[model samples]
Target: MTKKDHEESGLSKSVWSDADLEEMGWHDATVHALFLQPGEMASRLLLDLDYPVRWVPPVRRRDPFTFWVAPATLVFEEVWDLEGSLDFKGLAPELELDGIHRLAPPDGRAEYPLWHLEGHAFELKFRASGFRQYFRQAPRHVAGPMLEYADRGGCAFTEVGFD
Candidate 1:
């Protein structure tokens, strides 16, 4: 949430140590990125990269509308962990902008909950400086690395350190 908090909690702390990640069956540089386009457009990005990712239900809300219409946002948090890496820990929930589904596709007049899968694996972590900044302001969207996700899913992850 707050950079100051992350700095203070030692969650974002950097501790340099000698550790071989590659030798332990762990890879970090390979990034599998998924960008869900806006709802105005019709499309879906499905790739057989590495881990099959599940679609987490998006958070939504309703606002006062005088036009007898509603607007909603389809949000998704996909996660992956780097095994045998000593630098990072915990499941990292990467935010994804799933298409906003309306009562009518391509139309924003109708209100509806966004649809997403609960099972899938991602090949890479999403990092957009703008998003980080936005979440920093909101504080509620605070998310760490994919290691947390792996741990939560009962999957094994590793962390390596380089000194």
Candidate 2:
């Protein structure tokens, strides 16, 4: 989505503005972000599938071990510019689900499938505002086995990754 469209969606109007994004020290050009904590069942399934997985050490001093054994699926959500669509290397292919409507009015539900590939990510989900959008994961990370699956191939295991 364009910056204006993302802002016009009113998801984060109070926190940022188009003008504010132009500031010299602006950190990002999108709206909100989410760090998904996977549930037990999902995590177990990945391990059962024998997907390549690893745990990376946490970069932050306060954070717990970078590598962890959890039973849940994890994904990062962030509002970003159009450029995120570019890279797709080393990412796992995903099954794209379509036609899921947003739950909220004005702002609808956002849901879609994402495959992490070669330093990039692919997503096809609807946002909370009822807008159907796709996403590509960007660089920047905390290492872990989950990331190891980023380079996996073939469609057989794609559906297993999502909830």
Candidate 3:
């Protein structure tokens, strides 16, 4: 589905609007986990955006502009193809997201656009009909110093927050 479709369907209107995501680019976002299901039963890819981006706090605090990290999950639906390599041995690696791009489908056979996700440790190219992003929880206010150590361990969802 297109951006308008998602908006009209109220799929991404809860926590993030299109303008919000446009302003807060995916650069430097940490990928804490990746779940890809490619089969007749399910064809989708889910990415845990650990340290997505800095957002203004809803309520003002001592520091007028204290930084916050809003963790979210990005999902690609109706995935027809997926190809990539990720290391999943001892512990799940934290892949620093570089960027996400929408490109023309290869060979013009697919019904949807192609998505290319570039990261510091991995690269993925897939053809998906559409995608959506939703926050895992309220934006967690974090200290400026803590940002440096945010990705030092497993994802907040897997390590602590999520059950």
Candidate 4:
């Protein structure tokens, strides 16, 4: 998803930007991002299948800890960069599940079975006209354990260390 498409998809373009993300300690290549609907809130954050969910306020934070939205249906995988130049890769001609837009994995990554790679930043779009916030766990904190969790699905566990 290009920045243009991301913007056209209903994300608050004015609120989230590369500079804003940088100031908040995020880069364009942050791992997969989680989304929340307007006024939605959660008390804890789950990084993946392994790490135990920790308490964190889901609302009123400037890019709170890149938490996971449970029930799995709200998470999204993006193949674009928010801090880069505009991409004109127009939306796919076909619309699935009604009017919802889905992004496809790029080139070599197509071979990847998962929806998208972890650690490449997540793009959260609004479900309605309301405030939506996002934050991410740095790769140093999530990569190893999260990958282990994904591989195990549930049987295995990954322990995380605090900074």
Candidate models: Cα lDDT each: 0.21, 0.24, 0.60, 0.24
The residue ranges of model 3 lying beyond 4 angstroms of the native Cα positions read 1-24, 38-42, 55-66, 86-92, 144-163
Give the count of colliding residue pairs in each prediction.
30, 37, 0, 8
Model 2 lDDT tens row, 36-79: 33444331111111111123446787886542221122122332
Instruction: Name the top TM-score candidate.
Output: 3
Ranking by TM-score: 3, 2, 4, 1
Q: What is the TM-score of each candidate against the true structure?
A: 0.17, 0.20, 0.62, 0.18
Put down candidate 1 lDDT per residue, 3-58, tens digits, no spaces.
Answer: 23232222231211112111211111112233453333233222211121111223
Model 1 local distance difference test score: 0.21
- What's the residue-level lDDT of 95 in candidate 1? 31
List candidate 2 stretches off by more than 4 Å. Answer: 1-65, 73-119, 127-143, 147-163
User: Positional deviation of 97 in candidate 3, in angstroms?
Assistant: 0.4
Candidate 1: count the clashes: 30
User: Model 1, residue 29: displacement in angstroms?
Assistant: 7.7
Instruction: Name the weakest run of 10 consecutive residues (lDDT summed) in model 4.
Output: 93-102
Give candidate 1 misplaced runs (Cα > 4 Å): 1-4, 7-33, 41-148, 152-163
Candidate 3 minimal-lDDT segment of 10 residues: 1-10
Clashing residue pairs for model 4: 30-120, 30-121, 31-119, 31-120, 31-121, 33-122, 66-135, 66-136
Candidate maximizing lDDT: 3
Q: Clashing residue pairs in candidate 3, if any?
A: none
**Residue lDDT tens for model 4, 1-163:** 1222122212222122222322322122212222222223322111222221222343566744532211111222222221212222564321111111223434435422122122222222211111112212212223222334343333211222211
